[model samples]
Target: MKTYPVKGSVKLADGKPLASGVVVFAAPEMGMEFSSPLGDDGSFVLRSSYGDGAPEGTYKVRIERDPSKADSQARGGRKSAAPAPYPAKYGDESSSGLTAAVKPADNALDPFVLVK
Candidate 1:
């Protein structure tokens, strides 16, 4: 298999699940990307290649949903306040003790947080 699924929920700043929306994953360095659809439960899953995960760098993630699609696709999700902010950070590596450029296919990017 060349893919795996990542499960998570899209929640509001208030910590409530967002019924429907779209999440996009972009890794410029590795040129790999993915996206997932938010279900009524505000949960989603993005596909990652065999060993492809978020690299050790910054990412620009956006969440937007077509309201019109709601009537056609909304099983039980909400129309969200607004697509969150432009560019949310994911799988950073600055916090890690090791300081090196990402080398995917062999090295894994550990947990790192963005310094907003």
Candidate 2:
């Protein structure tokens, strides 16, 4: 299986970085999937479980906010008040409206912008 480095940034509707989250890429046809944690600036570099980059294919992209990280940053570390920053719709592959095509030679993906 070939691998290619895939990196990109995510931004909120207001044009600010997403801060922290997880970005998932699923290529069901190829039985390949990968995910990466978002940086403080909402940047991510996709890496597979085998420590290799993702294989070439089109992927369904999903972005989910990390609740544990959110809770700790929620002023008092309270879990209840730590609502997700992005809408629930964007957390699933079916509704995220995000996708990517990893070419055999290219290494980086374009930035993703999430809007409310």
Candidate 3:
């Protein structure tokens, strides 16, 4: 088993932080998926089932924000599921158009900017 440190941030096209989202790295060739929660700054670290890092391979990345969480936070904790700020295309691996190739070293991915 091999792994590498992977990390990056997500931003809107206008340069605002995505705030809260889940970062997914899907490696269908290896039959594995790694994920991590985005911080308030939209930064995330990829962690696989093996933990702490991801298997060395090519991966399609997707970042999805939980609308309910965003709504509640926006309304100061009153629970509500709002519409997603990003387009639907950004929520799926096949549509996001984001990819990364992880190596056996600290892989600092480039920042992803989601646009309509």
Candidate 4:
């Protein structure tokens, strides 16, 4: 399927960058999904298993911490697991209420600002 570039950033309601996590874009009706790791600045560029970008469609977006990173951090040296930076709701598209529309051209989405 043809795809288009999708990029965006995530920030807290207070204007602080999330710093780490993964951003997902899922189009359930199309059975297509894309994801990207959050940069230190909380920016992302979506890519699917097939390749970079996603096909044109509307998608429900979600943000979650990378499980591998979380696991490693837990076993590494930290005495206690640090609290999650974002609310749990942001991890579930059904409840997160985040969405994006990808067009045939380049798509630079608005920042997803989450509230605590």
Task: Please provide TM-scores, in order, for all candidate models, with all chains considered together.
Answer: 0.47, 0.88, 0.87, 0.88
- In candidate 4, what are the lDDT values of residues 1-116, reduced to their tens digit? 78899999999888988778899998888776799999889899988776678888889999988766776767557644677777899998989999999899999999999997
Write model 2 residue lDDT over 5-90, tens digit each, in one string: 88888888888888888999988787767999999988998887665568878889999878778777766545656556667788
lDDT of 3: 0.83
Two-way lDDT contest, 1 vs 3, winner? 3
Span of 10 residues, lowest total lDDT, candidate 2: 74-83
Q: For residues 23-109, write the lDDT of model 3, one tens digit per residue.
A: 899888777889888888988898766867798788898887766567667666567566666888888999999988888899888
RMSD in angstroms between candidate 3 and the native structure over all alpha carbons: 2.0
Q: Please provide, for model 1 over 54-94, each residue's C-alpha lDDT reduced to its tens digit, 9 standing for 90 to 100.
A: 44444445455635555555455754344332224322222
> What would the TM-score be for candidate 1 when compared with the true structure?
0.47
Clashing pairs in 4: none
lDDT (C-alpha) at residue 27 in model 4:
80
Candidate 3 — which residues are off by over 4 angstroms?
74-78
Q: If both were scored by TM-score, which would come out higher, candidate 1 or candidate 4? A: 4
Q: How does model 4 fare in lDDT?
A: 0.86
